[model samples]
Target: MSVPFALFTHCGIYEARVQDTFFVADQPLDDGNGNPPAGWGNPYQSGTITVTGQRAVFHDDLGHTVTFHERPGATSFLKLCA
Candidate 1:
């Protein structure tokens, strides 16, 4: 088994990629909170993730899509999830 590649952002979006699976979130990834955000059963659940070189694509089950572009020295727009 391969370890998932994790990407932490300052905006509270924690992402991980393993094979063709992907997980992303805007809050802490956990199940401690019984009331998780809509669509997400857990805080950091996997969704549809796709990567092509420096570009990453995340498609949420809630019809939302997030895209990330990797660049050198790019300032992060996300903050650590509390």
Candidate 2:
């Protein structure tokens, strides 16, 4: 299923929808300025993500799978971000 809902961080956990975006596990946990969470790695990447129902799958450029689960965040979306 395709969704504009890609590139989301559910409860502080990042999920890429591959057709929408990507994520790297070893990337910095934070930018080093208490940037909080959900924001990590390069905004542009080589891999891709796929989302099915409540589940998401990530794959690198080399076809390597990088899996991360989604958690429910209490935060709401801003007008601009939404």
Candidate 3:
């Protein structure tokens, strides 16, 4: 077998597709106050995320959820979700 491949493109976008729907994770960041930064404002969320097999998981200071699907690739998806 081989390790899965994932690519993160510019403009705060991550492309991880298999056969069905793709996963898109984006979170915005503030400048402490209402002020904005140059192309820095509204930055995507930088949290710990993992997509093993068909289960895409997102974890942060808050709770997280497991999205189940027939995502092709590895067995971790099942074991993780199961």
Best by lDDT: 1
Count of clashing pairs, candidate 1? 4
Please identify model 2 stretches exceeding 4 Å from their true place.
1-44, 74-82
Q: Per-residue lDDT tens digits of candidate 1, residues 23-81?
A: 34433433344333455533353456566665666665566455655543434433334
Task: Provide the global lDDT of candidate 2 against the true structure.
Answer: 0.38
- Let me know the TM-score candidate 1 reaches against the reference structure: 0.40
lDDT of every predicted structure (CA atoms): 0.46, 0.38, 0.36
Predicted model with the maximum TM-score: 1
Candidate scoring better on TM-score of 2 and 3: 2
**How many angstroms is residue 3 displaced in model 1 relative to the true structure, after the best TM-score fit?**
13
Worst ten in a row by lDDT for model 1: 1-10
**Candidate 1 Cα outliers beyond 4 Å, as residue runs:** 1-11, 14-42, 71-79
**Candidates ranked by TM-score, best first?**
1, 2, 3
lDDT-best of 1 and 3: 1
Model 2: lDDT of residue 17: 28
Tens-digit per-residue lDDT, 1-82, candidate 2:
4233323332333334243333323232333443324333344334555565445665544444445443344133222212
Runs in model 3 deviating more than 4 A are: 1-21, 24-41, 64-82
Looking at model 1, residue 18 earns an lDDT score of 40
lDDT of 3 by residue, 35-58 (tens): 222343133323354557655544
